[model samples]
Target: MALSLMLRNCPKLKGLSALSRGTFPVSRHQNFTQLVCKNRTALPLAVKCHNQFVKAIEPTRKMSADHSKLWSIEKLFSLILLGVVPATFICPNKILDNLFAVAVVMHFHWGLEACVVDYVRPIIVGPVLPKLALGLLYVVSATTLAALIYYNQHQIGIGQTFRKFWCISGTPADNEAKNQ
Candidate 1:
């Protein structure tokens, strides 16, 4: 209503409403430009000026099959873990221990990677900090995976370790007696 009233009151602006509606006369383009130049505030709403200093950034890739494959693998690992957890506890063996170690570490790495990517974004933090955080995440993930693999190879292994944790019912001597 205000716009209609404004246009009705100002004959100069009557063509502007038509221009916004796409029915602007071709001959009026020059007149519109002149009017816009004269009254900078009256520049057409549809007209946009681009800044040459700002370069357009395009996505580095259209689509990545590898990302989809990674997503599928992550989901598969998650599902496998559902069974692997119980199986490891039920029968703690070298194969199940190693499987548990690999799957758990990969699951943890993926989950932490997601957290780091989402929370430690360069836009939120500074560029340097995000890169540092990602590097730290990689280091931590690799260390954890390596340690688990080592423990599985040389020690009682992940499954047996967890089983031992559940089996702890008393003090050192009491537990030793129970085991004996």
Candidate 2:
């Protein structure tokens, strides 16, 4: 019903019915826009429909100071990661290892959080599931960060671990010989 109403109101969707019914013969010469709507109406209606759709899909929100600061911080952290990653690999130590672990886990957390916020919206998957997903993300991120930190502290650091893994050869004895 809503789709039919949208089709009726939007002049551009006039040929949708014909297209659906297979009566509208599509030709290579005719552009998709031409096929969709041949209506020669004023541009205002199309603009109005577009604005309405945008408003409906994405509700406007006033950007707070904290949001702006967080955005800047995220961008800065990403830029820092570019340097931290290579530097950690080149000079693997306690400080660099811990830094690498924290940086990577935080980056992963932020990325996953963004995905959860964007895709697991209340409107799409109901209110409870979205909250639950976000909570689970936090839990997983915390656990991962804790594990990485523990590994860095207790055993070989992330950089050394990766370096060791990268140096793998045909056999364990061959690896040991190469290391020695």
Candidate 3:
């Protein structure tokens, strides 16, 4: 406690404290930290500019209501997915089939977006690549959803396709037997 008090009161002693780390007791580290913080040099211009850039681009959050609501919506999407997938497979209603295709495609798009956001982070893959990757993911997801909806609208339908997959016995003879 005496050494800590000395460190707080004397600026000259703070200089000597850096050289005596091996001899310094653990209790005095807090005082030493304050000395270092108080004596820090002005940051470089590049670092100062970076801080200003970050401040301008990303303001401090006040309450983040949008962030909280987004999390709840993600969970709600999950619950919808849980209901829509099995229901599509079990019963072959045309309306339910169309809903399943749209809902599941949306769910997959969100899931893939999360993966792209995580793996293609600007820090790791460079700033431009992450944005490009995200764009590409959006294109692919749009194409997939369009194709699924088109198939559901113009062909045998999504539900019947899934039913055929579920009921297939993996042999031409068995398929023919079932068809007849």
Candidate 4:
């Protein structure tokens, strides 16, 4: 009844001579059933085609091994240093900035580690340390790095801060500030 009212109110449809011929009646339930049947018939074939395409492409895909073997303790330490050093020395804000910088570095490191464990490490040790341990380690490392950065920033003085923080040190602005 509502649909008929809507169709009646539609000025563009009212102007059409074909629509004025008569109210064309059809069963809504029958139309819906026809649409569902059409989609149902097509669905399985569509899924089969997609599965075939995926399978065909899967064999040709290559794993990226750029930092494949760089997962030792020394390398992890270096990564930590790379993240922490810049934040501690370079950032204008002390505690929070340093912590953020360290967190950013650790985040990338952890992500790379996770990818390596999931893809590369499976080929080596058959999923070492369980999934739970891996997740726990990531969370712990991130938290620890954040806390360490905050601690270091609070403990250190500005003069002892590394100049490596700014790409361009000893600029006119710095020199002017120093001169003052």
Candidate 5:
């Protein structure tokens, strides 16, 4: 009765009862059930087509080698960063700056390594490319850290450089004259 009153008050609600039953008077040329597939076909796919099927992974290989030790090392690096960042800003010690350079570089290398492993995977990029990429990464990281060490030893070091950037209050010419 309430529905009837609504239909009487609003003529647009006349077909609302039909909509509730999903009885829209519409038809398609092709049945959707035949068009859309629900499950994978059991036909002899690429793997099944071959004679020698892939073997199952060994049960003993559940965890990687030195997994716990590696995790602890990563955590140690993180702790060092937690201290080094603030100390670099506040005190700007040469030893701490060296530590900061090494620790920060190592942390960044590991993160970038994970990204390379995920994206430039052996399966997708082929075995040769992945190995080559990883080798290149190691070379670049080594040379970069070496250069950083050289800079820390010879120049004003990373912390002092950052401090100088903050200390400069006047124009570039004035700052240069002051340093000179």
Candidate 6:
């Protein structure tokens, strides 16, 4: 009777040990199959969405390519040389320089305008102040350029002039103390 009990208990204990050891593998298999099924179900939906998006953008992509090809390499180079080189080197009155400066400032202003229009809130008060400030800056830059042209025809001492223009208001002692 004891032997029968011992034999029955041994099989139960063995089964319990086997179950403890097999738990992780059985759970992992279940999880893996669940993941596979989820991915299989989602794959077709993702592919269909991607196809639809590509189809929607196809016409725009072709239009952009066609527009981009309008400016040939030779034409672009010629435009750059004609616009930039004479502005920097050949013009003696600095009119081209002033025009270039104004153009750059206007370009910056337009870029800021585009950014504000695209991303900023129409009712937000913060962007309005910055836009006004940028306008003031453009005016100041243009005025400074005009003053430079009026006062100095030759480029002599221009570096010294710039240094003086940006000179700090503090004494040399204050600069030395700050450096340390």
Instruction: Give per-residue CA lDDT, model 4, range 118-146, as digits (tens).
Output: 65544345565556566766787777777
Error of 3 at 103 (Å): 1.6
Which prediction has more favorable lDDT, 3 or 6? 3
Question: Which regions of candidate 1 deviate over 4 angstroms?
Answer: 1-66, 171-180
Model 6 spans > 4 angstroms off: 1-39, 43-125, 154-180
Compose the digit string of candidate 6's lDDT tens values, residues 50-164: 5655544343322335634534643555455457535554443445554544444444555555565445533355658656756666676667666655544566323334455
By the lDDT metric, which is better: model 1 or model 5? 1
Question: What lDDT score is found at residue 101 in candidate 1?
Answer: 82
Winner by lDDT between candidate 6 and candidate 2: 2
lDDT (0 to 1) per candidate:
0.74, 0.76, 0.70, 0.55, 0.70, 0.51
- Best TM-score among the predictions, by candidate number: 2
Write candidate 1's Cα lDDT for 1-180 as tens digits. 566545434654334445434333334446666656665555544352221111122213445456888999999999999999999999998899889888988999899889987788665577999888889988987898788888888999888898889977878999788879
- Model 3: residue 44 alpha-carbon error in angstroms: 25
Position 129, candidate 6: lDDT:
66
Off by over 4 Å in 4: 1-91, 118-124, 128-140, 157-160, 164-180
Tens digits of lDDT, candidate 5, 94-152? 79888988999899888888788778966467899988888988998898899888888
lDDT of 5: 0.70
In candidate 3, stretches whose alpha carbon ends up further than 4 angstroms from where it belongs are 1-65, 174-180
Better TM-score candidate (4, 6)? 4
Cα deviation of 52 in candidate 4 (Å)? 6.4
What is candidate 4's CA lDDT for residue 3? 72
Instruction: Kindly give the stretch of ten consecutive residues in candidate 5 with the minimal lDDT sum.
Output: 51-60
The digit string of per-residue lDDT tens for model 3 on 1-180 reads 566545544654344334323332334446755544554432233345455555544536465456677678777888987898888878877787778877777788888898998788775678999999999988998898888888878888787897888776768997887879
TM-score of 5: 0.60
Q: What tens digits encode model 2's per-residue C-alpha lDDT throughout 1-180?
A: 577556545754443333323335667888757755764442444555566566554535554546777778788889889999998888889888888788888888888999998899775688899999999999999999899889889998888988988777698798788879
Query: Model 2, stretches more than 4 Å misplaced?
Result: 1-58, 61-66, 172-180
Which sequence of candidate numbers ranks them by lDDT, best first?
A: 2, 1, 3, 5, 4, 6
**Candidate 2 lDDT score relative to the true structure:** 0.76
